[model samples]
Target: MARHTAFAAICVGICAAGATLGGCDRPAETAAPADVFLANVAEYCGKAFSGRVVANEPPADADPFADKNLVMHVRGCEQPSRELRIPFHVGDDRSRTWILSRTDSGLRLKHDHRHEDGSEDKVTIYGGDTVDSGSATRQEFPVDRESVALFQREGLKASVENTWAMEIHPGNIFAYELTRPGGRKFRVEFDLTEATELPPPPWGHE
Candidate 1:
């Protein structure tokens, strides 16, 4: 009887300590980086931001984006955490939409290019999947096999090895970047401090 009573008292003491220290309950698991990243970008749903080309190495003599207004509309967020569609507008051209979605392994990024008539471009839907667990504010995607085959078929062999990355600093800046071998670097940064007028939907989305 004495041993049982002592054991009961010890258990009671342990329980009291657990109650105070929260050690008895299992700790909540932290979200994976990919999930956190998706959630981070989803916060901008229904907003629009203006961007400018910040880096363009091997500058072209006739830059397509030069002096052109650039806008990114974060829309199509019915399933914000699962998928997001951001339309990238360059002046009068409204043919590009960036699709970000969560995959079983990690995340995926795809480009949807369309013609003015709403037809899919020949080299459309080409992008990549995240190869690792990027941070909550940034992710890198290497060109996938499917994209490589499409690029090869389209005679865009140089793009087969492309790597695309995105960075989001809440209330500060959102950046889109692309890099490849041979010193190719292109980046566009959007000011997240100011929300701009939402642009029209990309081709075929309207």
Candidate 2:
């Protein structure tokens, strides 16, 4: 009890001495769930991790990614805690990137696709925003009206109802998922415990 009291006294004296700077009694504001999730992912900025297809329904005999290496590079953290652009690399193809950013309401997720010549793909920048306060380790983004319109215009009726989700468990696994009606689902999980070599920047991001 005496040791505890002494520690408390010392803390109090320090606070009193720095009272002009700012009192230690200021109330702490708790970060929202979306913010926490973004921070959790930002912890892996500047690193690249290897991943594998964890789930892919309606399997195809000629899966394009079956024999290719899969990697995800967490980069473009220049926006500080506000945004991150993670490139999804499949072997030598660096055409896909996942852009996650903070929104006034919750969060936003978008897909950026580019050609080898650094040209933007026609059906690119289609994604959605979080509708609720998801947990710190996970967040789900349902197809928004804009993305739906884009898909419809591109004749991608099946993707109009797509819902994408991302999960990040520090030091364990980070997952990306896509689900839609008619039992369509795809998921890839990256091993966060080990970061692989940093790959080249996503196409158009160079």
In order, the Cα lDDT scores of the candidates are 0.83, 0.82
Local lDDT at 97 for model 2: 98
Writing each residue's lDDT as its tens digit, candidate 2 over 63-174 gives 8789789999989977635678999999999999999997777889999999999999998998999999998889999999999999999899999999999999888999
Q: Quote model 2's TM-score.
A: 0.85
If scored against the real structure, what TM-score would every candidate get?
0.86, 0.85
Model 1: weakest 10-residue lDDT segment is 19-28
* Number of the predicted model whose TM-score against the real structure is largest: 1
Q: What are the clashing pairs of model 2? A: none
lDDT of 2 at 33: 69
lDDT of 1 by residue, 40-116 (tens): 67777899999999999889899999999999989997765567899999999999999999787688999999999
List the pairs of residues colliding in candidate 1: none
